[model samples]
Target: MQKEELYKGMNPLEAAVSGAALEGAVASGLSDPFGSLDLLTIQVTPLAIGIRADGNNFVPIIPRSTTMPAQKDLIFTTAHDNQAEALIIVYEGEGKKVEENHLLGYFKITGIPLAPKGVPEIRVILDIDASSVLRVLAGVLMPGSHQPVNPVMGVRMPTVDDGHGWCAEALNRAYGSTLDLVTVHKKI
Candidate 1:
């Protein structure tokens, strides 16, 4: 959808607050306390509606984009319930084996009142960078090369070249699976 369609004239703050409340409710219902929210199931609507928190109303909107490691921006109204909160967790891969440590960002909305959970709105913008995949793999293969706070003895550190190879291998391994390299930008 178009950017204008997402906003529907609501200001950033209004979008952020409403989005956060809906997200907070979903987070509260998850089976795993620390699990990331599933992006595939989230339905994108054109306008905000009467999603209530405490006694207030809210509206949420997610932007449109075409890229890997999708970026999301959420906005909603201020909420009253302490239980009302929002969080964004980034994971590696599309399956159960995805790494949680790869989490890139997290956001929360607190101090919302119990009565006016629906009045105010909120806005959130998210951008996902997959470059860390390379870094993480490099660290795993060349343990000492990058240098962690406490390096264990007898551990071999791989060089930057090795990291590059690992990154390529990872992309290859994911070939025909969930990973594919695409030309994101073209020279003018």
Candidate 2:
């Protein structure tokens, strides 16, 4: 195709690039102008995904600009010593605090062996599939153990469809850092 046909009323550089693109598309047998038929295109996360940690902080596991079909795990510890149970409250947004973000879901990890604060390891994983579905998994683990003592809990995200703010608020009102977790730096 001529440059005039593919890029009408365009400057020389723009017309050349446009004509080349059209030729490349036709040469490659791409039926869609947007190239949606490509099977391996990338999609980025619309919002940051993380958990509610100590001091009411939003500790991000999968950052907002991360690509989809991503999985990330963060180590967290109990806020108080001998805290036998912890809450894994997931949120999605660009909030520095949990209250500013949307509540995705939550699960409680019980049956933790009693230990001093930050002694036990809690692995919280956030995964986002290419279809934009989010899954959260949390479990308690002993140091140097590859497996969890208790069964890991996996929860699909957006457990609250709307009024998510109130759900977060209600959780705070009901638990108020009693079951809070603190982020433990990755040792490896």
Candidate 3:
């Protein structure tokens, strides 16, 4: 085998030993070189993921630069009166508007049991692993209900390519607030 080829195929342990030997040979009392360097790599989220809120705004659940294997939950409510279902649209980006972001995917929680607007509590849970796989959980809680409805959908991130804005608009046009949700903000 060629000398360069033989050296290029060195295993991690072998490369570490050789690098240490070279560093020792180059060591000098002048100053410690390679300082302020990170020997280990840091894990981070590639994109900011969040749900759409009122006024079509993007409410970030997990912001960018967050470490991996992160999870977050946000409470939401129906946008219209006596809503029976809530649609959750998940997007990924740094943009404040959902139209400017990429739609990862969405799920709907039905059988909310007829409640006034902002009365039913819909919980949106986002779970992201180190591999960047995202799983979303939507739980709808209504008064006097035995349990939350089923049809819980979990999907991988980045489910859509182009035309995400059009998709959102179409969904709204078809559903007409039947699956709309808004962030539930409490004062004090």
Candidate 4:
């Protein structure tokens, strides 16, 4: 009831008692004090989103339960001598193994300058918009050029409906370590 109408048609003592009881209910968390219809709630991701690197390892980009509208980037190196490209296979979940995770999709960034293994820097970027749309971008810098090459290729996630495991296997078999990412370094 409106504040003006709450005490209407009631004795002064009755109105005061009723008001005190209502206040107690609210303060004690027995009732929602704000009865207005307008309310706002924040949303978060239910699972972690990430990519599969070499050795079937899952590298998390946006961790589980993180607030949406997020972006992250990770640096990786080619796993083979004179590697020409890097594959970015996106996945979702908390699993440590790539096969245990749900495959979203995959993209390849080609045209990497030929260099000894672990010499080139390949950057993988993940961006989640406010609407939960995901974007994968990969790029690299040439040995001599100062300008960075924009993503040679990209794809929206969750594009693979099934057979993702086979796809990953086939890619690994065909490319071996050429398109794989070098081992990630951990801080001591």
Top of the candidates by lDDT: 2
Looking at candidate 3, the ten consecutive residues that score lowest on lDDT are 29-38
Clash pairs of candidate 4?
none
- Per-residue lDDT tens digits for candidate 4, residues 81-182, read 888878888888899988788788887788887888887777677888877899888778655565676544556776573654777677668866557786
TM-scores, all models, native as reference: 0.22, 0.76, 0.69, 0.71
Local distance difference test, per candidate?
0.29, 0.83, 0.75, 0.75
Task: For candidate 3, list the clashing residue pairs, or say none.
Answer: none
Which 10-residue window in model 4 sums to the lowest lDDT?
33-42
Off by over 4 Å in 4: 1-37, 142-146, 150-152, 183-188
Candidate 3 lands at a TM-score of 0.69
Task: Show the lowest summed lDDT stretch of 10 residues, model 1.
Answer: 132-141
Whole-model lDDT, model 1: 0.29
lDDT for residue 167 in candidate 3, whole number 0-100: 78
**Best-to-worst ranking by TM-score:** 2, 4, 3, 1
Q: Can you write out model 2's per-residue Cα lDDT over 1-188, one digit (the tens) per residue?
A: 65554645669998779767766666577888677545444678878889899779999899988988899999898889889988888887897987788888887889988988888888888888877898888888888788897998888876683754787788789988889899888753
Kindly provide the TM-score of model 2 when superposed on the true structure, using C-alpha atoms: 0.76
